[model samples]
Target: MTKAPVTPLLDRVHTPDDLRKLPKSELRQLADELRTEMIDAVGSTGGHLGSGLGVVELTVAIHYIFNTPDDRLIWDVGHQAYPHKILTGRRDRIRTLRQGGGLSGFTKRAESEYDPFGAAHSSTSISAGLGFAVANKLAGTPGKAIAVIGDGAMSAGMAYEAMNNAEQAGNRLIVILNDNDMSIAPPVGGLSSYLARLVSSGRFLGLRDLAKKFAKRLPAPLQVAARKTDEYARGMAMGGTLFEELGFYYVGPIDGHDLDQLIPVLENVRDAAEGPCLIHVITQKGKGYGPAEEAADKYHGVQKFDVITGEQKKSAGGPPSYTNVFAKSLLSEAEQDNTICAITAAMPTGTGLDKFAAAFPERHFDVGIAEQHAVTFAAGLAAQGMRPFCAIYSTFLQRAFDQVVHDVAIQNLPVRFAIDRAGLVGADGATHAGSFDVTYLATLPNMVVMAAADEAELVHMVHTAAKYDSGPIAFRYPRGNGTGVELPETPQQLEIGKGRMVRGDEKQGRKVAILSLGTRLAESLKAADQLEAKGLSTSVADMRFAKPLDSALIRKLMATHEVIITVEEGSIGGLGAHVLTLASDEGLIDAGLKIRTLRLPDLFQDQDTPDKQYDEAGLNAPQIVDTVLSALRHNSAGVEEARA
Candidate 1:
């Protein structure tokens, strides 16, 4: 059993101001309590437990050394900010984490003053930290700015872009590389292994600076002879000088868990840093807890669990999630065809491609958190006549928008895009929500956009995408479980741009219709049922394709129905926007009819359960019914008032 932490010093810390009053000796005890508190709090709420646990000592050391709020400390990806948040006056509200109207799961500028730069995505810290550093420099302020990023996030080209620019410009900036050897899963590519080797050898700083000093201080005649000898000697001792060549003064391979080693180096670097610096601190991902340390990826994000047993609390099971279904379907496809291959940007498990990777090892590629490279690489495979499917979360795919446009769309490559989490992703909040994929992808020439109405349709769409070798085709699915519809074993191909009418009674004069896109079909059908009981006939259509919309079905529905409502699981520039565009072009608005679009509201959604968020956005069945009734009431009153 784990011993209870000493807590007297912790009770005194209400804020960072209070923390400053404590002596360095008491701060050590306080760090112990902070770790205990984090463990206890996350045990109840069950969020990003492993990341917070890994950074407890680092958090305490940073706060103890630097005067924050004034000193801008940016956290890359924000998963490791739980300990920081608890330390900075959010301790009492820790229980309300990821709940509706409570503490956010990730860093938010609006949530706290200490979180100066908000982040939910990886590899953004370097650029954001540079911005703050530049702003401080321009303002003639003498404040320190530091960016703490992980090795996994370092794979992204944007981080390298920021590092390249910072080194060239020779700005006085600090970048802490939190090396954990894992990013949800073990990191891929040679760069990851190279960094691992550099850290493992433990002579990065000694050899690097010694070589520099030897090269600079040598006589002119002897310099050329010494340079080659030093290069050979350096290679024998440490690995390549990638970061140094990029313009950073590299330091460390230090133990992140040990405060003694970390604090002194940080203090020295903080005082002596004149140009851009990279301090690589090696740490275990799930440092404190045994279960988490053993299964780092599983504990990265978890449901409520028993702290003692480390077993997840069961919440009633129903249908398999869309992710699971997609994984099975993709695996099934690759089983039959040898040419089909799968790829993801550091999310083999998240995108449900782990099974595919296992079934066909030769056909699977797990590119380290580099979305831009993933897309262009997929295009290269397609160019060479290989069927490549690039499956990525909708939010992450936004990182490769330019590549998707320039590389894939321009070339008209037959790249299949499986865009998972393509709606308001609950709990993870705005940064992880997949809102803009439909609008962005739909606008591209020769690009096909699709949304799955149910799990069966998702299987069909996957098959359709695999078979179609014309151009780039994308199919988006929501974050959670399917609607319990029985999936088909034999996959069927769907027409590129057709909409299916699910439920309706258009013969009667009570002609009001709800047009649904994607998973909202079930809720729309439920609303139609409620409307029918209230002596109003409602027609519901499930629009599978967003890009090439079924003009025939839409035209038929509009002509028959008095009121037309467009509902979607996504945002304003999505299904609703596409329907409006179609209606305007067909001159249906001038033909004496009422049309309104119902989508996710135009505001950043907060952390909540998926059902609660859908209800909050008026996308649930009861909420949809209320919206339709309100529209009908206004339409009826307008007719009555105009006659009067």
Candidate 2:
């Protein structure tokens, strides 16, 4: 049996202020308790596990050394901030992570004053930290900005962009490169630890400043040579030549887990009267927990699990997830056509491209966290007569919208965009919800946008995208499993801009027409059933394409039905906006014709279950029925009571 952590030191500590009161000798014990507490908290409430566990000692060290809430400390991606949250007066609500009205899975500004900036995305910490640093400098404040960025996040160009401009911040900016997975440098040891201490030391910086002044008196050539010699000598021992080139005094390859090594080095950087510094700290993901250390990626984000066994709770059997379905469909297509290639921006497993990579390693590309590069790369492949499916999460794809418009859409390349998670993502919350992709992509010229109604439709859309090489095409699917729809053995290549009737059409003389987009067809049908019970005939149509709307179907519905309701699993400027434009252009709305739209609300929804989220957004079945009734001069109170 694992020994329970003795948290006498931890129980007394409710905040970082409490932690500063304890002696440095007791910090190691506090770190141990913090680790145990984090693991136990995440066990009851599933969330990001490994990253937070990896940063336990670092979190303690930073908080203990710096005056938090005054000195800004930003964690890149915010997945590693749980331990930091625990240390900063949120230990009581630790178990309520990712639930409705609970602590957010990522760092949230509204939740605490300690979080200076809200961050859930990767590689933005450096830029945000620089803003804080420069703002403090301009105000002539002693408070510094510290950004702890992961190695994976460094793959993006934004981090480098921030680093190149970090000179203005000078001594006010401190960047800690958290090298956990990528061994960017040699292993950390006593020798590496000593160098980090020396380089970051006040005495070393003082001497370095004195040397720079002395070198300036010589010729420009000698000055250049002296600088190169000093930079190269340190660069050879450590591995931050690239960071050094970006106008930062680079230090380290220090062991992050050791508080003894961390505390002093941070103190040196904190007290230094020099330019912006980059400290490279090496840590292991899932450091304290045994099972997590064995399988870091699996524990990176997890469902609830047993504390001792490290066995995650297996989800009850259901239909295949939309991601797996897309992967399978893509792999099947690639098997038939050698020209088909798969590209993912550092999310092979999340996008289900790992299976494709395992089979056709040559055709698979895992571009590390750089969505812009991934989009352009796919465009290049497509321009060269290859069918490259750029599979990215809708939120991540937003990072590359410029490339999508300039490189793919304007050029009219045959880059098949597989947009995963195209709606409200449950536990990941607002930062990860794919709410804006349909609105953004549909507005772009020369782009075909389609959303899958079910798993079978997803299979068909995949086949459709692979076959169509005329222009840039995109297909979006939700984040969860399908509605237990049967998998099609032979996937059909759907006709572009055409829709199918899921219920009664114009022939039935329906008074109510429910035009649905994406996976909202299921809920629309449910609304139709309630409408039918209330002595009202309702028609449901699954409009597959959002960009190239089936004008004939929409025109017919608007002319025949008295009440027309458009429902989609996206934001306001999507299908509803397009349909409104269509209606105004053609003057489709006749006398007494009512039109209503059901979509996600304007405000950003917080963390909750998928059902609760949809209900809150007013996109569920009852809400759809209510929208239809409200449009018509009918009693909507019946549906409201049923919903209750």
Candidate 3:
């Protein structure tokens, strides 16, 4: 259990090419150093740790055996690709992971040739790898597409879809099922390793093919029996019947931590020419770290931590997160109604519904990595007169858009969509950013979209969504702690198309109006304060609902104010677009009233602090002030002169 003070072997290798040059005997030492390096780097940077730790040896084995950059290795979800990143010429930048202007937390094609396909979402690697493999085959090229996908990702239907069509790629496609969590086939030991190596070996494969030829020449009924016998024997030993049925040549249940098993089995698969192969490798999450191994989720996602004690940096006590507020509020609602239930697409803790699950196990459904199914399942529940809350991240909900449209919105099913992480998420970057939910969901018919300005607002929204039974209702909240506002003693039901005013109305010279949505209310208020000081009367309205457009409030603002602006923490076609449409529809723009919309820039923003991201998106207080000043046709100094 002693850690190395230096990564001597790892220091000499900058890329997988360098790694491939090392002797097979030295690989174990190299793997040990790689593990230490990943641990040290993640401990400093604070990102996905446990999954990366589990894959250290498996990563080393893949890079060592395959001719990568040409071989095309894709990691499913890519949170587990840190060690892969370190081995593939990104070791020096490993410490900069998930930071602004630094390496991405997931696999990105722009970052390195080693990452052939960019992936942050689960169950995509196999599909992407199949494309690469089929491309190489069609081009008559010299490469294989290797997909290292975890078992958690395999619960999704896409992996099997890719496998069913993998026969076209011949031996060019290889799937390494990284069995780290929710193991599909949990048998891994000496026997498993032996069988894995034996099945994948040249001699065993040669004999099987020879037996197949003999069996094909037999009588039709006997040939069927022979094929069944051969398949069942391997299936009984390796537990690969499912994959084999999907047209994959299956190997393993091999110990992933053992370099000896991984390297040889990978080598056998590499040399084989008959396969669209799958190698099942079992590994432990948080493999090399003691504290991580001892904890649940295995320190899956973490803040910066001490390498020695494995203690993460504690947060200075602050307000409860919006997620927590939502969980508690939903739990309270559930207590009142027996028919109310909750569902998450394998994101119990992230959505803060783990506590809800604990409280009402019978009503909670964790629909393992299948967002498509989760939405439809909730619709089914709602159709039967149960109030079902389907809590999911905005980014993930994109996967179930069809179901949202067909099953919920079209049918007018009463399903509540508790959307968490509804804006630009900080460290997880553009892929995980929940930027499009408002834009996409708002456009759908029979859909009501609301965004919480703060924790208190989230509580009210949750209650409102629960009460709403006419159609699909979705409420969005951001990904951080609340604004520390006092919660209402009892949650209130907000009127569907109404908004509340926060600051000045028609009193002080009647000039500017700022319509705020989501968590940008604080910034809008600050902008109003700045505008007031600059001799411009400003009104701040929290337009809580993104859909239905608060027609009364918006029309009133347009009538009273000369200049109007809309601000929201979403992409181009969100609150701003809707407000502009409302103004256009009413022919209010023809009356010489100038209107501008402030929203997230029309681009995918990278990872950074929430404040920096907002600033970059031009949705901050300063930006809001700038938008108003420009609309009024006055510079800061000019505004002062006008006031004087």
Candidate 4:
């Protein structure tokens, strides 16, 4: 284990209040110590490193200048909040980030009073900050609402919408545009290019230039006095015309890493009594770390690493990840079909569309961090007779639910939705868990939803979506590796709304039938093995399609088996609810057959290993076996009572 870095100035600080007690001279030292401490902590725990490193100086300056907890400071996306966490009384638990029962990787309202608004999603901070500012004005609160948003987050429409309404908050809202020229990937879109131009314009005025400009407008005696005023300092540095047009007092293009420049500028902005201010602070994503600074992605997210060498720990070799499989399959499909195009909402690498982007540059569209636009854009493409694959993570797809329903599903566009990270994503916690996609998408009319049992199945589903032109079709797959299934050399286009029985014949006296959806087939097969050992014949069926569910297979299972259990790695209204509704409509359950549903519990599960999360949610192999046994016992009791 690596020893924690020596943080002399940081050791003296326990909270933001402790930071405020220190003089301006020690702030630079404190920032350095804070950076070292943060790097060390993240090195052990393995989390968002580059973002926190970029915001070290800015974090110190904000907490020191602003009266936090009273002054609501919200970090956009909260990936950069590690430094904020350390300063706001969480330094003791900093090493426990993203662990089972430790500090969350992102800012959580329940975790700290300093975190006024919790966030994991991007571009939400400005709107949340505006709400806070407006509420504080109504309540006559003393503090301001500061939103530190990234340049990448600016690509989303929500930020601009909030900026447009910022005037309502009066002088209480402060938006700090943390421009590092990157989000998760190198930022795309016009906003990115515009920000780059703004940074490179070289129009930033120094303090002397500010004084000279102010001195010209004042009398000789007042001229000297005017130079010392906060207004003069603000006027010198404040020149982002684009933001000014949006009703914000634009104040920056300042050095974010330089505490000397940041502290005074922020102090001036805090005291200015302006309506709404936007401080554009320039920074490098991986500011101090050598390895991160040199790397293309700047080590955005990393595993546990050597502090000295900056070498990350290697994963144990296994089957290719589901993401890689999807990428390969999509590329293969794209090779044959000229009409097939790909789209991602600022998540090229995360959704495995980066490879597709490389292969078909002209055909791929990275629409920044705009999921809603991506959905509608894909709809437009599909309407124009082009096959558009809008590959998005299931969690993020929630943001564009309205678009899916109104634009695509209602119009019956042939848009292919490749939803990655379809189930519990460990460490990111409930906010990022893809638990409700099945419920949301499956509920929509003209929408076909499928979940892959393994990587091979995912390939077939991709082909199926490409071939199907009736309406919007979506296939969901899990976050991690496949179940070691051999990939088919030539992918087959699966028949829509059909399921395959992986184990046991329907006529082989099967007492219990396990209807598995998504990647829970592995656990279902395990449960079937356990049931067979216990002298109870069990059949396992991989019900791939959630929407337009395999009604024929479901009927066969209902007719043959005395006990039928529906299992999926989703929430209540997903596979189980669909099955129950179908059976009830068909009058299948009216017979003396026992039925049970296994799914993620109603409440949101916290950060843990995928296996542990499934166990907690009662969707594991043992839980499946228990559900089957318990249902069988209930049926046996009913039969005996009737005989008596």
RMSD of each: 4.5, 2.4, 1.8, 6.1
Any idea how many clashes model 3 has? 0
Candidate 4, TM-score vs. the true structure? 0.91
Query: TM-scores across all candidates?
Result: 0.90, 0.98, 0.98, 0.91
Candidate 3 structure quality by residue, lDDT tens digits, 118-237: 999999998998999999988999999999999489888778888899898899999999888646776566887898999899999999999899888999999999988878999998
How displaced is residue 216 in candidate 1, in Å? 7.2
Over 310-379, each residue of candidate 2 has an lDDT whose tens digit, in order, gives 9999998999999999999999999999999999999999999999999999999999999999999999
Ranking by lDDT: 2, 3, 4, 1
lDDT, candidate 3, residue 513? Answer: 90
lDDT of each: 0.81, 0.92, 0.90, 0.87
Q: Where does candidate 2 have its weakest 10-residue lDDT segment? A: 635-644
> Which pairs clash in the backbone of model 1?
none
Candidate 1 TM-score over all chains jointly: 0.90
Q: What does candidate 1's lDDT look like per residue over 374-410, in tens digits?
A: 9999999999998999999999999999999999999
How many clashes in each structure?
0, 0, 0, 0
lDDT of 4 by residue, 316-346 (tens): 8999999999999889989999999999998
Best by lDDT: 2
Residue 553 lDDT in candidate 3: 83
